[model samples]
Target: MAQGNIGGLAGGMGRFTELRQRLLFVLGALIVYRIGCYVPVPGVNPDAMIAMMQAQGGGIVDMFNMFSGGALHRFSIFALNVMPYISASIVIQLGVHIFPALKALQKEGESGRRKITQYSRLGAVLLAVVQGGSIATALQNQVAPGGMPVVYAPGLGFVITAIVALTAGTIFLMWVGEQVTERGIGNGVSLIIFSGIVAGLPGAVLHTFELFRDGSISAISMILIALVVAAFTLLVVFVERGQRRITVNYARRQGGRNAYMNQTSFLPLKLNMAGVIPPIFASSILAFPATLSMWSGQAAGATWLQRVANALAPGEPLHMIVFAAMIIGFAFFYTALVFNSQETAENLKKSGALIPGIRPGRATADYVDGVLTRLTAAGSLYLVAVCLLPEIMRTQLGTSFYFGGTSLLIVVVVVMDFIAQVQAHLMSHQYESLLKKANLKGSSRGGLSRG
Candidate 1:
């Protein structure tokens, strides 16, 4: 019996080993990404950029830097992060709906998808070049609060080198993401972002502790902030997993010799279907001007531009309102793009499934639309609350915690997804074992019958 138990444990351990291998592959890819973050773009003065970033604290710039895992502050090769790729994807998605040719390609399935992806890649490269050039130009003009240069050499050579390095870094990241998806577990791009956020946690925690030691924040405030973070994390888990189940009844049809009756199923619509994309998009869009303004030194002619930029700075009241609005709007917009009520209704109708008390076509579509609208509202509110809570804490409590709602949400969601994937692999392994046992038992019974 002891031997049998040992064998069972070994079998279970083997399954875990398989899962561990997959996770190791993912971890390896993430290590590569972190290494890339440290590789500076050729010709950049790392010391100068770091000093400038340290001086310009709290604003859209800070937010973007956080997303890039401090690489932006270093002016590293991966300073651009994956923003350009995301922007390209958004543009392509929009084009697929508006442009007839792209729409036709979208309808063509896998091959069309490949073509669209190619186009998106090209678009990403173009955006990276533009954004990189913009950043390089901004660096030349931007001055630290103490009148220090952010860039050592402010010439065409530096600009060109920075742009090329940044663009190449983004493309390399795109490749890394693809490799992770193909060879490892978890969505590659999401995992990259997840890793970045997780990496920053240590520094953010250290900063919080420093603030406490310096008496900048009260002990009670630290407790309050912890409580807020825990509450927000729990809230995000709830809303992210929250779903509305729409019941559907399918009337079965008769086959050659048998008659079939009705069956029931449910359609699950997640409350936060758009996930964290909206906040990222909204932040990136707003950060553009602020980033440029910081780069441009807020010169005499651009004084008005600087004022507007400051007003729209992250953590400010007006900026928060606009950011919130943009988040809500994008949540709705992206939700519509991914979930088409009309298409869902038509597909269900074609499959002979209909929601009880609703017609198969237009009425069902309307019902779905109504439900989605309500769900989106709830989701948007949850997002706003999670996002704004941290900002409020920063303002009211004088806490130095750098983790924001967007980062927390992404980290939590990605972790949940990673866990689910691992669990699924384990479940499959268990099922296989059970099947093998059943087959062995059947074979033994057959042999006994022969004896």
Candidate 2:
């Protein structure tokens, strides 16, 4: 897909140059983020922190670390990544439907969007503080089980500094993400997460190879893993691209004597309308209890918290049930929020279009809604199957099963989007060159006529 995007650039160095500049801009920004992933916050021992992560980051911590590009494992300033911002945005987005004031602001156009963004920023800052404070408090008790300290200096002073630094880091990353979206290529936050996951690919590959060689993973199992991953990727691409097209016909209109012909179009509804939002939301919410229990002074409540965390840990039956339910629920909820059949029916009715057999207004809306509900059901089931199967395998098979469906989903979708963006830039560049040549030719023809 990426190759196809850049293939037409052979005709003009200018387009290539422009594409290169955009790619370079994105690359440089990612480089900065990657560098920040290594810069540890004050009062934490980087080596010790990594060791602790190896010991404990098998669930929520690991998931967050992937999103942060391994910053969480490093206990770096960027440990929180843009999660605070993402969670904030999701909260505000959900609020739009729940709150009348937010709903009004949503319909206010570009100005409204800016206001919502500002609100999200504020929310992100607050979340950063809360999450950062949690990390600091958690660090106060972070021991390697064998008595090695993860935090070299742990106190109120350290906590305050850590919170401030962590919040600042998240804010900076938010700014970087904005810049990447405005000036570079693809979604910045997603790309950052993608970079982190892909960055670990080499090490994971080597580790798996080593395991296979050492008889830890048998030849048949290795072959099966590869085949399953390939099949899963194909399934994801197929479903992600799959769409249900509802045909609509527009009434003919006579403008200047001759009757105009009727026009036809189709409204495309994706199979997976909810996308990655459901799983991510589910994971974040489910991880909260464990995150809450990380406080150092929660010793009085430690036993209960530990039991709760254990029950909710990855591969646990309760965790699987809750996770699946949430994914399915959010799938429908977010799908409804995004694609309102009533709104669509109203817009089509206003525009003099009708879905062939369906009556206008209520009937059309009902038809659309019913179809959407069915699609969401199928999509949610797919989500549960794809996400849970991998985790189930990991629980039974072992911890080396790192490339879960969630990671694959993010990787596939983001890569496709990134390639699409690159293609857009390339197409735009080609058009610009064509316009310039046409303008020059017109000028030359005019000069010749004058002469």
Candidate 3:
């Protein structure tokens, strides 16, 4: 499927310099990001960090390392990745609906959007600072099983340096992502995360092989795991492409011989309009508290913080329940934010179109909202099942199984979105080529007529 998209785009590349440049720019940006992943921060012992991660073994840490393209394991500058930015964006988005001033700003147009974006950026920076500091403090107390400290020189100087390095790395990534969105292809942040996950695939496969060799998992279990992943991938693709189309009919304008014909179109409402955002948001929010608790619990030996961290650990009942609920809630919340039923109804009314058997104003909004609510509920349920099932399976398997449902969902959705964008560019190129040919033909015919 990916090959087909690339082939189609390449077929038309000769006539589309802009698309070619955009693709190249995206490639270059991703390469730059991958390079940054290996650049270690100062004052940290990368070897010790790796040893600590291996000694602790797989679970949340492994998942985070995968997301960071192994930067977390190495304690590289990009260890935070774009998670702080994502968390900050979620807070800002929620604020827009809750605060009157923000809601008004949202209503305001381009300038309002710029203000909101600025706010999100600032929030990201703040979150990055706090998270980076927590990581620095946590590292101070962390020691590998071999008795080597994760940090070479643990002091205020080291803490300050680590915080500065991490925050700078995150800020750089945010800039790269924004540039990609404006000058390249797909979503910058999502693509960054996608690249990290893709880069980790080889390592994950190798680790699984090691496990098999060590007799941690049977061949039959491995086969079953592969089949399950394949099945889930198919399920994700099907559901992501699923949509509910509402038939909209334009009112006839005239009743004479030259009367205008009524036109019919369908409004496509996606099953998961929120895409992979809900899970990302839920993960970010949940991880924030866990990180803080772990930091405090380890540094100060606080019993309460330890209990909180334990309860929120992945695969715990409370963790699973909260995670599922948050996924469903964010699914609804993000869907509402992205697709406003009232706005759609107003647009349709202005264009003299109405849903079949529905009134043209508020009633239309109500009907559309009803349909969307049902679809979102189903979609949210699907998301919860996809995200939680892997955790449950991992618990039962008693082994670290890479490519959990969240990772799989993210991989599939990002690829789908990227391919769709490539196809769009290809279509646009073809349309322009046809227009140019028509213009040339018309000019030639005029010259012949004059002769």
What is the clash count for each candidate, in the order shown? 0, 0, 0
Candidate 3 ranges beyond 4 A from true positions: 1-13, 16-21, 56-62, 103-109, 252-260, 285-290, 297-301
Predicted candidate 2 versus true structure: per-residue lDDT over 1-451, tens digit per residue: 3533344354477677767887899999999999999999999988888887786655578788877778998889999998899899989988997888999998999999999999999999999999999878878777765678988878999999999999999999999988988888999888887887887788888998999989888887787778878888888989999999999999787697777779999999999998989999898788877765554334775788777877898889999999999999999999988787998999999999999889999999999999999999999999998898888877877636667667889999999899999999888877876676677668878999999
* Model 2 TM-score (2 dp): 0.92
TM-score of each: 0.92, 0.92, 0.88
Candidate 2 wrongly placed segments (more than 4 Å) = 1-11, 256-260, 292-298, 438-451
On residues 125-150, what C-alpha lDDT tens digit does candidate 1 reach at each position? 99999989988877777666566666
For candidate 3, the 10 contiguous residues with the lowest summed lDDT are 291-300
Query: lDDT tens digits, residues 1-451, model 3?
Result: 4744564465466647788799999999999999999998898888898888776653355667788889988989999999888878878887887788998998899999999999999998999899889878888988887889888889999999989999999999999999999998799999999999889888778988899999988898788878878888999999999999999998776787777778999999999888778887787677765556544545556777667767777888998999999999999988987788998999999998988888899999999999999999999999998988888878866655677767889899899999998888778788876676667668878999999
lDDT of 1 at 235: 86
Which of 1 and 2 is the better model by lDDT?
Answer: 2
Q: The CA-based lDDT of model 1 is what?
A: 0.84
In order, candidate lDDTs are 0.84, 0.86, 0.85
